[model samples]
Target: MGKSLLVLENLSPGRNLDAYMQSVSAIPVLSVEEERELTERLHYQEDLDAARRLVMSHLRFVVHVAKSYSGYGLPLGDLIQEGNVGLMKAVKRFDPTVGVRLVSFAVHWIKAEMHEFILRNWRIVKVATTKAQRKMFFNLRSMKKGLGWMNNDEVEAIAADLGVDAKVVRQMEGRMAASDTAFDAPVSDDDDSAYQAPANYLEDHSADPAHQVEHQNWEEDSQRRLMQAMGELDERSQDILAQRWLSEDKATLHELAAKYQVSAERIRQLEKNAMKKIRVTMEA
Candidate 1:
């Protein structure tokens, strides 16, 4: 089967999309008897020739599914390519005994591959992560009637139909409406437009010298106060506090209790008292 699949690799949709479409369309569609026979040969006998015939016959269906996703701004060739992958997977897992045509079973796999491709390449940041959002992302586009934003009533209607909150519908609409922008503006001869890029005006406050110095001083002061407060406690209390909080591998309450030869509750009490005293000292 591996060698047979490789033979059909050249038939894949490529840069010459029109030619690829024509070629796949030219291949004759299989009859019910022919399809069943090929599927059985591939399924039970592991016949590579039967597998190749099955995949080749299904190429036209893959193209048809990929065309519906043309609005996503992805290359049609790429969409067809992804759909082809799904078709191949469907072929590999297909059971002729299921009493369903291969085309009916393959539709889900075909659309699934194309969906993943769109989500990955649609934007610089992902627009949909959850199951509901993914469903909304595809359906909402078709549900929209015009170029303008959806009105409140339209939003509510679509939300109810899709079984999502109205807010979620609006959120996905916003994501789809947005377009990618370059952080740095393209090089232009016009001076006025050059300063409009995000890189020109957005400030990085972390790099400011005053902020850096203030953050460093605050951290040092906090550390100094913590040390002073801890020093004021008894030696045993200090050891417990250090083991519980300061050590790289901090001791658990039960472990500390075993070492101190006390119950776990006693260790919790000591830890609580130590934290309270530290907080009071730091605040003072």
Candidate 2:
């Protein structure tokens, strides 16, 4: 079974997917007793042959799971291969004493691998990153009521169903609708169309002299206004504000309280009042 299984595993679905599917489909599914025996051998005895047999008997299940993900626009053969990897992992970790069928247990591992593969290759930029976003990415298509963009009601419904924010649902929908555009125009594109590439329009403003001068002026003006506001405060208030905020070593409320011979609560109140005055002055 080991040698034969290895040969079957090497059957590149990319080369001939039909033949590969046929081969996997022909491998007989194990009965409950047979499955348990094989799983026990692999789990307790560390029998490699038993593991191979377990994986072989379940290859058809991997195919069945992979086919459902065909709408992702990835190669079906690659998806099946990924699912096969998951199946092998499931077989390796399966505990026969758990009292569950292998197919039922392996489904999670099978879909996990396929999901990872789809996320990795579906777009040049990843559409989903967080756990919530990943969940929405996979299910958003099915939940959508129409081919067009989802309305507010639909968005709200999907958000409630998926336990995510309505804004997040809209964001995921936008990401899904977006197609990857090359940074640079294709070489075959003529001058009329070449400027349409993101490379042409997404200019770097950081190095622009006029923009730099404007930012510097704004910062200097803000600093001047802040300093003038601080000058308007009494000497003690100025020191408190400076030590608490502008100083390299900031003073805690207790430290400032002790220095000023006031209670910590009094220090906090003074600090709050000072900040409020500063904000009013700055805004004025």
Candidate 3:
């Protein structure tokens, strides 16, 4: 993991996505026989060289798959990198006995990684979270005819096709159409425009005395509950919890082990049990 991160850290896909794409494209695709040989060697013999070759040959395919997600407004390089990670994962799990080509099996994994990346970075507020919404988000983008808003008929068609309500389709449409705005007025804004910013008109709930008192009560009650729970624990359990979690400079398992004259694993088990007991007591 460390080695992979170090290698990928030097790769700036956003700097020159075209150049990176061209580089991956130049890598040769493996023939069916060649792929099988590599897959068999990796699967049966656990050959790292075979795995490396398999991943190298499929780098171009990752780029190809990444291209379809270009509409998400993210850099092509980032998408391709994410796809490459998916490809590597697929390669790791490739089964020679599956009776299918590696690319066919890998497409799902590759697209899944790219989809996650797109959803995470596409909007300030997530546009799609549920499995159904994710399916609709991708399908809706492709189904729409043009940049214009979908008409009533179009919305109904999309709703029926995606197995969702028309209102849901409209909601997603509105979310996609929305753009991010500054929370405060820009430096160049005049007095008139400054008042239009969210900061100017938004209510400050923190300043409300009722809210402040309620928050303070909640905090004090939580602390009281925690102390009560801690008091319920045995001396050893209390010490373990306090040293491991509540201390400014926390104690390590080995250090605790030495102090208690117990194995580090035993210390870890005690720590785990102590936490579980604390949670149970607090909840009760």
Candidate 4:
């Protein structure tokens, strides 16, 4: 009962789809008596072996269902793998007393998984999110006859059939019609076409030559002022500030206290007073 029903032993659809399909196809269909016995073993005794047998026999069905979703442009092997997951879930919950064949019960789960995969991988930006939108998304694809956009009558008819607003259908149609573009120009693009890339248009003003020079000059002035202020501090205070604030290996108050043979609190007070004078001098 605790073990997995789906036996995915090196049967990666992504790695080698043809071989995986052949392997699943080779698993024989279970007889009714055999199905019943396995179901009983799973339901009553929580037999993992029986669950595995039941799943193995029905893998062909998952493959069949996954094939229908090939139009979404997803890898067929990935779809089959997802459907197998759904089948396992269905088997894990299947009861001997359900009175329906495992295929009938498992169809929903299998299709649900496939549908999720399609919605996710079909686009970088999701076209469908809501329950209503999801229903419309799948239906709209089938309803569409060609590459051309749907007309007013077609939109109205689809909306009526699907029990949603025509506006929603139009929006989803637009989303499906839209294609993703890379931000930067492609390597193969010539200089003539390169200007069309978003990277060319969306320039960062902060990195402009004029702005870079202004920022660098301002930073240098600030650092010069900070150094002049530090030079005004007493030798002990300047050493503490340099070790604690300016050094790559910053000295702790306790470490400074050990070096100076003073209490940590005394070092902390000296650091604080030196910082206040530096800030005042820099601001001036």
Candidate 5:
């Protein structure tokens, strides 16, 4: 008799990977005859249990494929889970009439999901994208052994072998060899050797505490000077400057001209002169 359906439902894939694998592995693989029969049932009869058995039997194969992608630094469990999902998709779509093994058909879908996961999670800076770059990201690592840097001949050879441009190979090579460096030096640099850190030579004046404070004071002083200069103007000038320059509902030259009963050209001249005076006062 088949295993109790209720007992099988208790199985959690994440509780223990080993237990999950062992349990799924215990589901007998279909023989050629058995596979044909079960696949036929799933394909035509739409039997859910047959689909379940077909999926369960292939879990070990998914684990095998997941292991090959171990260098990507993503959690193996997550990769396996993604692969399992792909496997199910394959099972659902498998045609028993075509007469191919389920594992053979599922391999493409399983790797596709795992590849997407790796591309997303592998690094903050995405090293690879595009169909060609994706091919290079995985294979190029293996090609680069003993790395000071690949010489031009080596780059050309790798490019030729991989069916890609030499320039692309050079770019991928540079990305792989590169490492992230901090903008500031570490706190523990006490010796003269600490001068080697990037922070010593590449100074950022904008980030300096003293400079930042001075900048704030200068901005405030400029604003005060501008306001003082505006105070020197007549009431009409003050209103024009405030409404035309400062307030949220800014007054245009035409609007100010209509209000003061002058040509738009005259209003434009007054506004320009006011800006120049403000600049001179602020500089002083």
Candidate 6:
């Protein structure tokens, strides 16, 4: 299991959030030597405590990155929690031998987690699932800062910057601009706008008399075959089949066992035999 994430639901954002920010910021930045030493200990010795200290010291940086995602309307604490998970993963994989600072290497991982969290919760359904779409999704959100729609030059410029075709950029923008609405209307007394919803236009083609009769005939034929197959079993087997297979919320082996004063194993065996006999009879 992954690390359990912290939730923002319990945070009031009153005095407690202020205190948390102050406390985390006050944690002295690890010196170059100190960071290397801790990272090495965790890397070679597998010292979990060393890893924990490294994560804690970097919590403030996560806060700084999470602040940029505030406009997403998600809980700040949740964003920070996702960022923390990314930080831990970076710590576990970091190599001080690579000749790069830990924070510099960790920035990509931190934003990746935060970006996923925002995209998932930003809409009722996901807008982007592939790598190409993910690039377009974020680029379009940034481009939407000013307007009803983008001008031609603006779209081309964004396409060039993101290395996608201008036509693809326009399509992505159009998708992002659309909004979702309920399929059905609310209970309303006003006749003027009541029929404006899609529910009024949705057709139930199966309500036709010919289709209804066909469906009824199919059900009757299936039921007749089921009864004929069940009759191939003995009386006790039929009762067991009815209770275990045909009942709504069919009986469990334990329930059948209690009813017949037998072990659950015996009930299961009988049920299995009854089913096999029915299947074989139906096949014949």
The number of the candidate with the highest TM-score is 1
Query: Per-residue lDDT of 35-128 in model 4, one digit per residue for the tens?
Result: 9999999999999989888888898899899888888888898999899999999999998797989999999999999989898989889999
- TM-score for each candidate, following the candidate numbering: 0.88, 0.71, 0.69, 0.67, 0.62, 0.65
Q: Report the lDDT tens digits of candidate 6 across residue range 1-284.
A: 01111222233333376656665676678889999999999989999988977887887899899888797778887888789889999999999899888999898899999889887887776777888898788777776658678889888888888888999988888777766667777786378887878889988898989999999999998788889988878887898889877789888889878988999999889989989887787667
Q: Judge candidate 4 at residue 189 and give its lDDT.
A: 97
**lDDT (Cα, tens digit) per residue for candidate 1, span 1-284:** 34434444555566677767877777788899999999999999999889878888999899998999999899999999899899989998899999999999999999999999999999998999887789899999889999899999999999899887999999999999998878898876378887888888999999999999999999999999999999988888899999988899999989989998999999889889988998999999
Give the CA lDDT, 0 to 100, for residue 3 in model 6.
18
- Per-residue lDDT tens digits for candidate 3, residues 81-167, read 899889999999999899999999999999999999999988888988999888888988999998989999999999998888999
Give Cα-based local distance difference scores for all models: 0.89, 0.90, 0.87, 0.90, 0.81, 0.81
What's the CA error at residue 58 for candidate 1, in Å?
A: 0.8
Write the residue-wise lDDT of candidate 5 on 155-210 in tens digits.
88889999889999989877766655665667786777678778778877789999
Per-residue accuracy of model 2 over 201-263 as CA lDDT, tens digit each = 999999899999999999999999999999999999999999999899999999999998999
Clashing pairs in 5: none
Q: In candidate 2, residue 52 scores what lDDT? A: 81
TM-score of 3: 0.69
How do these models rank on TM-score, best leading? 1, 2, 3, 4, 6, 5
Distance from true position, residue 268, model 1, in Å?
4.1
Q: Model 1: C-alpha RMSD to truth?
A: 3.2
Where model 2 places Cα greater than 4 Å from the true spot, the runs are 1-7, 207-284
Model 6, poorest ten-residue lDDT window? 1-10
If both were scored by TM-score, which would come out higher, candidate 1 or candidate 4? Answer: 1
Q: Say which prediction, candidate 2 or candidate 6, comes out ahead on TM-score.
A: 2
